[model samples]
Target: MVLWENLQAVLAQRGVAGFGVTTAAPFPEMAARLEDAVASGRSAGLPFTFGDPATAADIRVSFPWASRLVVVATSYLPAAGSPGAGVPGRARIARFATRDHYRPLREALEAVAGLLTAAGHRAAVVSDDHRLVDRAAAVRAGVGWPGKSTLVLVPGAGPWVLLGSVVTDAELPVSEPMRRTCGTCVACLPACPTGAIVAPGMLDARRCLAAVLQSAGWIPLELRAAVGDRLYGCDDCLEACPPGDRALATATAEQGSVDVSRLLAMDDATLRAEFPHFYVPRNSGRWLRRNCLVVLGNTGGAAAIGVLAGYAGHRDSMLRGHAVWALGRIDDPRGRGVLTRVAASDPDAAVVAEAATALAGTLTG
Candidate 1:
């Protein structure tokens, strides 16, 4: 076993606020899911091929030689009233997404990896991908527990934290998983406008606003109304819980409020410049723009009509389609002309169909 003092000192210097270690075991479900993930990604427009198992079996096979799975938690929650603070209209980016935790977390994990490698031990660091739910793994690792809202809530950090795991061949002291502390709290369930959290600890991701906003492809119309002005992940469930409300309020009060209007107005260049570390840019800005359109439609006020109209003729097929949908929601007469124009001229069949449908809805309404 490695000296606990040395490991703790290393983490302290690396700025990791809290961490834990768990035994790496054979997770059969995870392995099967990995195979399906690879096959699906191959046809799902993923740039590169992912092998059946993302995590090498060697890690588990050599677990007899390895010591522990070092899990780390970093405090990414902004201080109260920080720039990330506010409701959907103000467009608060989740603290984790805004600061871009992957790289910094990776760097910190690497430092720990370095220490082990130098000691002639094997180590690997895992970060976020579509397949692995890092939060679930963290919860199982004893760093936290899944709350009513389906977010991993750490004891001190609440749910406003991001997790990363370092699986190593070296065994270290381990921490027990935190017990479910929800204590019959049902605040998050009622708070979800779409009822994505039908039951505690069970999240239908398809209905989860956060998952919906981050998703690629067309959003069904039925869910749009419930999505509200949320340009990205929905925080209502989180905001409504007592612990969440208090934690977010405290964090935001310390940090300045986020401005949704400013976020909507940011062009591609400004977005890249402003949110250099953000995950939104990685999607090439299409999903963000689409999400903004949904929020604009939900606003349904004169202020957003012009902006929605402006995007009606955007070159991006996804942007144009969402613009047309937003125009339908706003019921702006001016949108009729733009929709008709797009309906006739857009090369993408899906864009053309959406525009035509929006035009028809406006004329009939």
Candidate 2:
């Protein structure tokens, strides 16, 4: 018991915002919920969420002697006045991805695990890994309750905290689950631009702007408009919650708004170094460029049309299609000329179709 208390203190000193211990039991209910979600197509396009239910539900499967689970929350919120303010002609990234919180969270958990090992107990640390359903562990440990946005909402920190856990054989005292709930507050439901939140605690990843942005391939036309100027992740749902405002106020802003024009001009190496925390698919710059094109269409001025015109004949169908879309959105004479050329000569069927559709929209509008 004394060791557990000391471990908690150590985590706090190391900047872990909140933490709790719980029995390392399989999360049968969570597993069932995941299965149902997948069956309903709510988990569409997310490969990470489609593993064997039993494996994710049971920590003991990975660490057979596991008896206790220590779940920890780390706040990635930037300090006050750290440039989180929205910038016109720039893209907004989700709050959580502003910095690499996983590294520090892992270190803190490992430290706790070391203490357990020194006491003759085995330990395994996991953070942002696919091995366990981290949210379930946090909920069971009383670290926080799951918010409607599908984020673990810490008491004062709201949903701006990242979650991780340390599974061990130590028989530490367990914390009771939180009794709090979001209740009748449906703020996040209407706030989702793509209406991804179908229920109080349910989220459909297919329609989620954040999920779509992270996903590889072309952005679906229907959801493209709702994506707005967000280049990476969406924060509309979190921003709408009352508690979320407080969390933002206290969080240290780690990143400033991204300049879409600058991003479009960057090469692979430049993009990777500029946003190291971003999940750039296969270390390719095309994904970032793809997103930047969307932002350009949404917020760019006459200057953007010239920049976008360059990609009108891009070899990559995804880029060429999006470039056509941006050209149509800008609706400038130069952009129109490029679109006409792509519509007539682009070899890719998808790109040709998109160009024709975009050109038609321009003529009609």
RMSD of each: 4.6, 1.9
Q: Against the unseen true structure, what C-alpha lDDT does each candidate score?
A: 0.67, 0.81
Cα displacement (Å) at residue 240, model 1: 3.0
lDDT (Cα, tens digit) per residue for candidate 2, span 158-213: 77778889888889999999998887778899999888999878899999988888
Number of the predicted model whose lDDT against the real structure is largest: 2
Q: Give the clash total for candidate 2.
A: 7
Off by over 4 Å in 2: 80-88, 251-254
TM per candidate comes to 0.77, 0.95
Per-residue lDDT of model 1, residues 28-115, tens digit only: 5545544564554422333221243444322455344555678777766553234443243455454455546566578878888888
